[model samples]
Target: MQAWQGIDEFVSVVEQGSFTKAGQQLQVSTAHVSRSINALEKRLAVKLLHRSTRQVSTTATGQIYYQQCRQLLDGLLDANRTVNQLNTTPSGLIKITAPIYYGERIIAPLFNRLLQQYPDIELDLQLSNHNVELISEGFDLAIRLGSLADSSLMARRIGSRHFDVVASKSYFARCGQPHTIDELNQHNCLRGISDHWHFDVDGRRKDLRIHGSWRCNSGLAVARAAMDGIGIAQLPHYYTDNAVEDGRLMRVLEQHRPHSEGIWAVYPQNRHLSTKLRVVIDFLAAELGEQR
Candidate 1:
């Protein structure tokens, strides 16, 4: 008699293809299943099924009704599961990987706070420039910077970063500032890890191959060199913000600075994400989003 009555029995009958099978699935008698469908059809004012001794099948209207009922049932199950999961306490070891400098300066501190809040959680942090295989290496999460390559791994953008083309005040005074990307060829450009410098030329990303007397694999080393009047260098804001603010270094070619790129939290794809890992990612997104 209720509006919600008979939807389950009707859907089960259509899926099982017979009243007896539907009764077996729902743990009710075939007569009960038939009565429920009959009541449902009468309430809806439609002939919902074609009954025959060999098999039972839905009418055209019943087919449409079954589809809608199935979706509603699925949504109800999901809602119940979400409510149950809300009560689950996060407790587990989470393995994470990140680049060396950023990991130490940014991610490590945020995780330290997370551990303080959840004492049961444990962390295994790996700091390396090399991108490791997440699934094979057993990492639960990775903090990745800039543009990500095409990957099967899932990613969430936590924050953003932009490059700063900087030189020491003394270096700029002696060598002059590069007002345009082409002028970089004339100045002594310090190279870090790669000889290609990134910039924006007329609203398009441009990677300019640079020649420099100074080269270093460490960004900190390159930043220090630029501060000591070595040459101009391109580095992220974290590397140069303090120096630039304190008048130790100067930013040039502001018009050519590339658009800010994403800082991402990446993890392997899974059907169900665990509570601990989910908590960690949410914490990172909240903390880093504030910083930006």
Candidate 2:
């Protein structure tokens, strides 16, 4: 604890550029801050900062020490924020981003429900298909599906995404059914995978390069194309849940149905997460789990 106090004083002096300013900010006398830093230097046996008339400068060793000390202090401050947030009501605008199709069909409803339950919470939702940086773009959270490319963010799995290749009943009636992965090459495919399809066989994953004239970036568009007898499309279970149940679309190569990945609520890596974000994440996990 005494070491921490010493570190605090040292960091304050460096940031404020003067012992007097640092002492004022810490609500202590200049002499006390100087004494704390001196004690720290004696304990560490290293000169941390070079003092001058106008400002204090850090040596290479000081830079390293400052970084470590800043990390510790920031961690402590973050913990305090978390504790305070737990006791405080969540009433701030939380910015969230999600893919377009999922945002409209899945995320939007859940977000609306959250908003209803916590009227104090304000939501700024961005619906797009492009991947964006969570920290640099300043999003509080993001709902992502499939594989996570960036390992830096923290991800909490909310649900599983099951995928199947399907075509409209009319399309199947014309081109026939595909019983094997190889048979898919004989028919017109919707080609949503950027000219490829993934499959699972005997507990192993496989990627099969596919070809088609109709290419689409939108899942809904691909589904719509398949429904119009344009081609077969590989789509997530949620996208074709109602249609598949209603016999609007027919599933093909059931054994080749791709392995289900997870749905995740992701956020930037933080030493401590806010209460509002944690509650919402837990709520989403619980709600989506129940839905499954």
Candidate 3:
């Protein structure tokens, strides 16, 4: 440990740009910080710093040394955290983000049950339709729906959902049920956030560019319009499932039903997850039904 004694102090001095700041951060005297770094340099037999009146900088060798030291320090921190987390229960303020509708309808209810079980765990959940930067925005987790694009964060599939091409039974009675993909263009389609609707043509996925008199960004609103006999709308299962079951809306284009997309819980890349995040994600994966 002798060689490691001043290693951290040296890293802090280089990173913090001054011995005084490093000492303040480490809660040691500036003199002690300087002495330890000087001792490390002597022990290593290398000049590690380029010191001036106003600033302290790393030498070329020091930069390489700093990189290695940083990895070692980070590894040590992660090891300590892992050991501590192992002994502890899932208790912490969990900050997360999810889509507005899903958060209100699904995540909120499921997390409420989790709160009932782990009363010590606190929640700071933000509901939004927009994508947020997890690390920069300080979110511990995110519940994202649909196929994810290439990203740096780690993701676990919790569930899946599909679009139900649906309309009111009355509307189907008047217009007649269209049986094929090309027939969709002949009908009045209620649009959602995207005018492009997705479908499964044979085994491959296809996007249907649609147009209509009734259009809205919210799936709930789009479903409501379909119920009111406005037009056929492709709505998410979560929004339309109850109505479909209750006979308020009739599912059309059963053969062209788009492939179910995955629901995911994403988090920052860490060596190991804290118990709170792990348990919640597991609960979601187990409790949230698949292949909707």
Q: Candidate 3 lDDT, tens digit per residue, 44-109?
A: 999999989899999999999999999999999988998888788889899999999999999999
Off by over 4 Å in 3: 1-86, 289-291
| Ten contiguous residues minimizing lDDT sum, candidate 2 | 1-10
User: What local distance difference test score does each model get?
Assistant: 0.91, 0.87, 0.91
RMSD over all Cα atoms, model 2: 4.0
Q: Predictions ranked by TM-score, top down?
A: 1, 2, 3
Candidate 1: tens digits of C-alpha lDDT, residues 205-246: 999999989898999999999999999999998899999999
Off by over 4 Å in 1: 1-3, 13-30, 45-64, 135-138, 150-153, 193-195, 201-206, 245-248, 269-273
Model 2: lDDT to the true structure:
0.87
Candidate 2's TM-score? 0.75
Report the lDDT tens digits of candidate 2 across residue range 45-138: 9999998887798989999999999998888888788779889887888999999988899888998898888888888999988778888999
Error of 3 at 248 (Å): 0.6
Better of 2 and 3 by lDDT: 3
